[model samples]
Target chain A: MKKLINAVEDVVVDSLRGVAAAHPDSLKVDLDHRIVLRASGPVDGKVGLVSGGGSGHEPLHSGYVGRGMLDAACCGEVFTSPVPDQITEATKAVDGGAGVLHIVKNYTGDVMNFDMAAEMASMEAGTRVESVVIADDVAVQDSLYTAGRRGVGLTVLAEKILGAAAEEKRDLDALLALAQRINEGGRSFGVALTSCTVPAAGKPTFDLSDNEMELGVGIHGEPGRETTTLGTAADVASQIVEPILADRDFTASPVIAMLNGMGGTPLIEQYLVWGEIAKILAGKGVTVARTLVGNHITSLEMAGCSLTLLSADDDLLTLWDAPVETPGLRWGC
Target chain B: MKKLINAVEDVVVDSLRGVAAAHPDSLKVDLDHRIVLRASGPVDGKVGLVSGGGSGHEPLHSGYVGRGMLDAACCGEVFTSPVPDQITEATKAVDGGAGVLHIVKNYTGDVMNFDMAAEMASMEAGTRVESVVIADDVAVQDSLYTAGRRGVGLTVLAEKILGAAAEEKRDLDALLALAQRINEGGRSFGVALTSCTVPAAGKPTFDLSDNEMELGVGIHGEPGRETTTLGTAADVASQIVEPILADRDFTASPVIAMLNGMGGTPLIEQYLVWGEIAKILAGKGVTVARTLVGNHITSLEMAGCSLTLLSADDDLLTLWDAPVETPGLRWGC
Candidate 1:
């Protein structure tokens, strides 16, 4: 298949350099090291935040490195976690006097790599490192094998809220706590209209006929919770959100809603899906106080969307409102 | 043809409601009038930045509302510009005494509607409104019916940089000028491996065979400038970046590069593409200051990627370093 890359092997590093070149203002490229960070050094009084996993979920790690979000983001090979060395370097880059917090999605490699980096960072004197492993996707009922639900969508929300808290000059403890709150409260579920091809795999991750879709696919394009006949946008949204609402009791509180594109779905359709999702949530008396529609977090070019709902309280709300300046998920005053 | 929406007509409104419910702390939805804003009132002296366009480019407008970026985002229907009423509403919602600046992508409908809204806001007392249109896509060589090149990717970078400028208390004219500079200095090009389905259209925007791709597509699933045999990611990136480099003389200046996913392209592949792009740029002697990889602007289910390069000066870099808080992009002090 034709692509815009050189040898498939050099794709990841070359892309990281390109990103650093493009956003010199907000990001830096460690060509020798594969780390992206806010151009400025870490803030003096605030704890530094770092997060990354696979290379393809663009704007997730790298795009999200800036003022209100990640201090640095490491890109691994596509769908692969950065090695501990990369994460360790990122920790060093963002480590101000304050500690660093790693927001890791619950994927086997991602968890392990980030965990290793955190441990490495902790070994340094005065370097307080902590992690919030986000497993927001409800796709996998069996948490063990599939990294306990495969932290699909909530990573963006968690970064924004936590970035805000960090911007507020909160201590590492408070920042970590808030990150956990956002992650714990948010539940995400996604479906795939088609399977995506991993370059190494060189084919569709799974097969979906014209009239079928895989519900609850992993970010790396793994099989979803179930495969069913293709349904309408509303039906798909319901399938993704129902489980999330059920798990989080979204009906009882106002929620932050995200109808994210699975790389291939257009924003035109994301809004269409969001419209239907609103009706479902309204019917359940779930007050959707805030909503985001479009591809915030994506699964390569999978033709689908995921729904993420973060139940909120005042603190979470305040943190969500905190100001941030990352390439992804920035907001608040 | 199945979609996640209730009725195609109600898509925008319903989606807005869902957004409101989802982030009550960070975003408040004006259901009666579809406008999203930071839940809090306009900051006392900070510039109120407002941007909006068709709904297909998620996290572009709405996902960007917050302290460091946009104060409000008015969302229109899929691939269609928001109406003037919506823009006016968003203006009022975000019009702090500091005035409002509309960050518009260079699309026919978006420019017209935002222009109208700016005029409307002028009529409304105590509101100062200005706009800057971003025409950064270099894919369309022709400057005819489609209003020159469609504003495909640079929207996110412009918003974040200009948003930071606004946050820094730059006067309206300065902010608008900065916004213009970002637009002028940035250029992008793309290639599509597969066409995405527009939910309302209920079919692929275009068709591609198993081994082919369309080059230079717009974010709303619009056709690219040409159709060619699919090529390697490096070749694609070379084509995408060559025009950009040639157009702006990028080899002479520091650049901020982006390898954006057109939804369906996997990150693994994007990295491959990025890696290739970096080599090409490096060979050209272009000093890449920073970079971003992933899906920032996307077309629905389109399996492709775009490359964006923004030539930066010291001022733009400063703004990039400035703190920002938005749902889509965030960063530091």
Candidate 2:
């Protein structure tokens, strides 16, 4: 693997060091705990938002740590869940007087580890913690690392919306209800033209023929619905959007659409696919209120794209439009 | 190639359709001319900014067409310069009462075409136009596409700083001077681990063995200084930074650094490489005032990165901190 990295074991810490060096005004990093915290965080009487997962999907957890997004992100090794100790430290570091909310993806390891950390934080430090597991990927009911459905691109949306709500000082209960509502309203599906190589593995996670693609691959190269021959951008857009639209009826409310790149795809192709998807959505009478087109959540350098649609109302749209200052997603700030 | 495209000839137009569909609120697309214009442009007496080049280096010209940025971007075919007609149309479309400024990169075709467009706009439409050609790449004295130097990553920084100045109602003369100052103060260098495939080419632009890399490579896979064996991130960081520091002294003033991805490299590795770069800069006493770490200007899906450092004074730093809302870069909207 010709990656721009030093030793494989130092990847996560070294990246965190870069994050710390890059965003000294906005982000604070704890190299010992592998947690990234907001530089000006733990506001008194404000709800603290925390989320984390594996490392490869960047600008997701750690990159989202800032004023209007996440208060802290507990980063794990590449494609590996952060230990319970790391999560506990992150929760404690961000807990204000109000409470802490853990925004987690629906991986079995992540779910269990976050749960254990929540218990530890509450029992040891009297910090009230709530967890919301995002399982918005409609690609598969079960995956290699997940039980029900994998949490894919929707985690980025959930973090933004919830972060805005938390910034509004919503109590932990209200934030919990909003998180569940977001999880219900969102659906995602991905396709991988190539597999990503982990730093430790030093080889591609899986093999894909040049003419073939994984139709509904998970973020970590998990087996998808099927492997199919490559098609045109229009066909790929339909294949991605059809499953998402079928999984949920988005015609009722205005939807927030995200045409996210799976790390390796360029923005030109992302926009092209987004154009086709927009046409399909408009034809199907779905009103898209807002759209985000870029790489928000990714699986290392996997060359594919994913579509996530959230059936949004005016309130959710307002929250999304509110000022956010994270490195991954920022606007109106 | 396994690109998400409809056809080889339609890549530029189709991608523009997606861009138009994605950012309707902020951008307007002239499908016939293949120009992306700001939706709220021609601001009475504000000096207009127009920039364009080839299509493959995305988010370079087109994606920067929004508030506090370029007023128009002419989209050429992949790796091909925009014709004089397209540039002239874009110039006329964005020419306010004050004047219009053309930000042209140093590529031979681009420089020539933009010059022709400036003359056409001045002669045919009686619109005043001024041009500033940027050649900031220190990789080589000349390349296949450029006369003096390849305008690699510095175009992004120049557009942003100049865009902010234009928003402040700087006239064409002042904007031209500022653009020249920015071009003089900035230096860029790139490395490519693998090559990218153009849609029309249907194959990789260049080849490199698994353990080899092209150091000081041009943005369009132009031959670099040499093909060297791959090194660790620390060694690669030194290899990139040494030549830049040798060419210019960044320690005298604050620097705005951008560690940009060459499209296909993932953020994890980019940050890891950035960590080492930060160490080198700090050790060398280069005070970085602002840092941008992600894909800004890209060369399709080439797997590598480039570093851009713009030595800035107080005025330029203030301009750099101004609000910019574009599909490629958005902050403090």
Tell me each candidate's RMSD, in Å, in order.
Answer: 5.8, 0.7
Output the TM-score of candidate 1: 0.73
Poorest stretch of ten by lDDT in candidate 2 chain A: A39-48
Poorest stretch of ten by lDDT in candidate 1 chain A: A324-333
Q: Global lDDT of each model?
A: 0.75, 0.92
What DockQ results do all the predictions give, each relative to the true complex?
A: 0.34, 0.88
Deviating ranges (above 4 Å) for candidate 2:
none
Q: Which model scores highest in TM-score?
A: 2
Task: Please tell me what DockQ candidate 2 reaches.
Answer: 0.88
Summarize candidate 2's per-residue lDDT along A1-333 as a digit string, tens digits: 989998999999999999998999999999999999988869898888989999999988899998778999999999999999999998998888899999999999999999999999999899999899999999899878989999988899999999999899989999999999999999999999999999899899999998999999999999899999999999999999999888889999999999999999999999999999999999999998999999999999999999999999988999999999989888899
lDDT, residue A49, candidate 2: 91
* lDDT computed for candidate 1: 0.75
Top-scoring candidate (lDDT): 2
Candidate whose DockQ is highest? 2
